[model samples]
Target: MSDPAPVSTIVFDVNETLLDITTLEPLFERLFGDAAMLRAWFAELVLYSQAVTLSGKYTPFGELAGGILRMVGENNSVAITDADISELKSLIVSMPAYVDVKPALDRLRAAGFQLVTLTNSAPSPSPTPLEKAGIAGLFDRHFSVADVEKFKPHPDTYDMVAKAMGVEPSGLCMVACHVWDTIGAQSAGWQGALVTRPNNNALHAPNVPTPDFINSDLAALAGQIIDANTAAGKE
Candidate 1:
């Protein structure tokens, strides 16, 4: 049997990739008045996501956010009301994108690449921070893993993206700052690109699958993708 064709669609991981979650730290600290507790809460939210997926229990990302915040409150000896939790959830929907996002996305689009965004966030009442960032229209499709009820490093979540985008796993490149996410995509038979941002220092697990490409920024990645596609006759 012949191998599948080279990649054609470029799917991005939203949170730490296109969007900058660091901007939300001040907001979280202001709301909780404990920076350390807020950081721990964010970390725990990731832990819970994996736990829930492994246990076959699914919760919306918004619900997980609230639950994590409440856990932070409990740990910090702070009392948080339901209303406060609701407001905090709303704030989460407004987190800003990274400064380089718009130009990078525009370059990719201009290069004739099909662009899509795949996020672990839930479908919210209002436009997500990506939409607010003025780059939402740049994406051919925006998908939330909420539909699949799974999180990153879960094959199901990556599969949901491939199915929705109407592309074979081999024809898609999953790009993210998170190594685990890229590893998951690679494991699921998709090409993967790891964006090596400075603050993102999580080590790839031993014996975990490595991504097809790793670059320090999207501009570099865009160039590499174009060169790769040209060499593969996909351009």
Candidate 2:
């Protein structure tokens, strides 16, 4: 096998990786009496998005989020209405970037890496997650899986990143907090970085593509990328 490819461009996963979804925990707690259910609901959102996509039907992320939140509330015997879902979604746009995100973006950009975002969210008429977090200008391009009608962890969705960024898959590195995302991207010939988030773990399944760099947060992952490139230059 050829040696691992170097990263020429970095594509980020936006929702939990850049904008912290935990900001919505209080709303879940108020409605369900348990903040931790927010994590479960999000896990369902991701699963259902891919489940339908894999079955050759596609549902947009926001719609899946609404449906899953209702399911979760019903399971807990809480009464969440359509108006409550709308109110919860309204909070999505106002989430601040995670503490590690801005410095990591600054470092990677300054070190000459082209930055881009590829999210599962549909193209929105309103400001997107990055725009809402005030970092839209940091990206060279922003792509949504809506363009391909597929949610990520699908090889097709990961493959689209290369075309959107005008590079070979090997020249791209996917930075994500989810192991499945890293696995999908690396499987499609890109390098991968995993940011260790709460309850997230290293992938250990047979034939899985392990992360090229695994760090506790984005700032540390950016440092890994920068240092790796600097060391390569010396040789």
lDDT of 2 by residue, 1-235 (tens): 1244466899999888898888998998899788998888988888888899889998788888889999988888888898988977787767789999999999999999999998888877757667878888998988889988999988888778787678998788899999999988988988888898787777877888789888988999999888876776667
Best by lDDT: 2
Clashing residue pairs in all predictions, respectively, total 0, 0
Candidate 2 TM-score over all chains jointly: 0.95
Task: Quote the positional error of residue 198 for candidate 1 in Å.
Answer: 4.5
Q: Candidate 1: global Cα-lDDT?
A: 0.78
Q: List model 1 lDDT by residue over 68-144, tens digit each.
A: 88887887787878987887776677777777777778888887889998888877654657778778899998888
Residue pairs whose backbone atoms clash in candidate 1: none
Cα deviation in Å at residue 234, candidate 2? Answer: 4.6
